[model samples]
Target: MALLHKAHITPTKLELLAAWLPARPWYAGDGPLTRVAAARFDDPAGEVGVETLLVRAGEGPVLHVPVTYRGAPLDGAEEHLIGVTEHSVLGKRWVYDGTADPVYVSTLVEVIRTAGNEAVEEFEVDGGRVSREVDLKLTGSGAEVAPATEITGHRDGDPTVISTATVTLNVNRVPLIVVDPADKGVLSACWTGQETPAVLVHLR
Candidate 1:
């Protein structure tokens, strides 16, 4: 499988984002992404991993996303984001865009389900990679989650590392869901009523 060099920052991942982010409905398309930064989360596997990033496109507000990459490309992924380009450290390549891919999503959900659910940990690496993870149990919850395929990756000057994992689970007891007030989505409170609640993750 084509993999990115851990110790170096490369344009391969950036190019992948160049094609994927604008395709999302949430993307605010103003112009090219002027600046891009990354932060790694924790990953037990030393291979591919997870990352959080701020992609600043032109003068528009930057878009924040958590991405998980895996082994090379899977079949038809070449049309998406794959292979090595002129700007990478390993000279080899890594899978760039995998969010839309089911394999990637499933892996993330699995990791979350198995991870420890006590608190949320947020950290930022030297190269600008910011990450967050939590641990929660989703046994009775009706929602389905995916396992983490490749762990998160980060670059701190000469050394690149996958920080840690952030797991999220649901435990029913007055739920609090955050939404954009600009939208007409219903709002709920976590302290709605004192009752034994069951928490569940709603994965749409």
Candidate 2:
């Protein structure tokens, strides 16, 4: 289930990026044109492969991020992107959504761990904080993806489990990180893309 198929051809990569980049928080410009380049990254599942994308938009700026996806057109993913073009790879066109993809989440964890100046504990919901982590998980493999991670601690709960990823580098001055329970004070997030979002204990 690698990001690209043998017959998927290189041209399809741009088509997919046109639909994916704008939806991201880092994406800037007013629906600027984009140029896509080849990208690949580490895969934890060894099932659904990962993709590192280099996108240049409207002569404004460029973005690099890893995307992991599966299945057919992702439900509710149409409104978030430019367009999901069909590919001859899996016979049917798959959704190009990256925001909710587990692979992307896992990569975010790694990036934060790499870019931060020091280990910092923080919390964020939409997209804030210099360094933070989550206990959320995403479910559904191959296009039917959804968040599988959730808050595992109760109010005033003991912080035995560190539900945060270490911010490695300061992305746009705002350090990025994850809150997955798999993170053990360090940074860790698992992307199985096998189930839906559910409340799970932080494994740290």
Candidate 3:
């Protein structure tokens, strides 16, 4: 389960992404970005925040960006930092590109191999638990997967690939309108407004 607080955050996520997205070589948007949906993955240690955001800039294709927030800096990952922000409840948060975070990589691989279901998110407000709806639904292939000691992500094309020693994951950075059910060894999701499910990642 993912617990959410009703606290404020300085330099909102969109504000941060707006500044960071343009600098990426794969970004094709020239206008403002609007968030479509978001989902979270639980951190067993409860020390890091793992969330994926779906956003689109103007009329461009929807983009998937996963980010991890930590209380302290990640060692040897200075280049992946998406700048720090002050969390009203958690104090200062050091955000980094999820691809470089071990926690994110491990959780993603586990989800793919186990075909895990999405975790429930609840907002704690006034001592009451309010269930938060997840607009996107994700499912994996449930096949045996090889363990990866080293992982790297490439974002130069439409389908971004994250490669390891044994497996290569093709993540659709820009989601498609219709999903192909014939596609195998993949992770896919569908939003509330979309008619068909979009392929998020495929094992290659």
TM-score, one value per model: 0.43, 0.41, 0.90
Predicted structure with the largest lDDT when compared to the true one: 3
Give the total clashing residue pairs for model 3: 0
Sort every candidate by TM-score, greatest first.
3, 1, 2
Off by over 4 Å in 3: 147-157
**Better candidate number, 2 or 3, judged by TM-score:** 3
Better of 1 and 3 by TM-score: 3
Taken over the whole model, the C-alpha lDDT of each candidate is 0.40, 0.37, 0.78
What RMSD, rounded to one decimal, does every model reach?
12.8, 15.6, 2.0
Report how far residue 192 has shifted in candidate 3, in Å: 2.8
Candidate 3 lDDT over residue span 8-84, tens digit each:
88888888888888877667765789998888888778888998788999988788888999999999889788888
The alpha-carbon deviation from the true structure for residue 163 of candidate 2, after best TM-score superposition, in angstroms, is 9.0
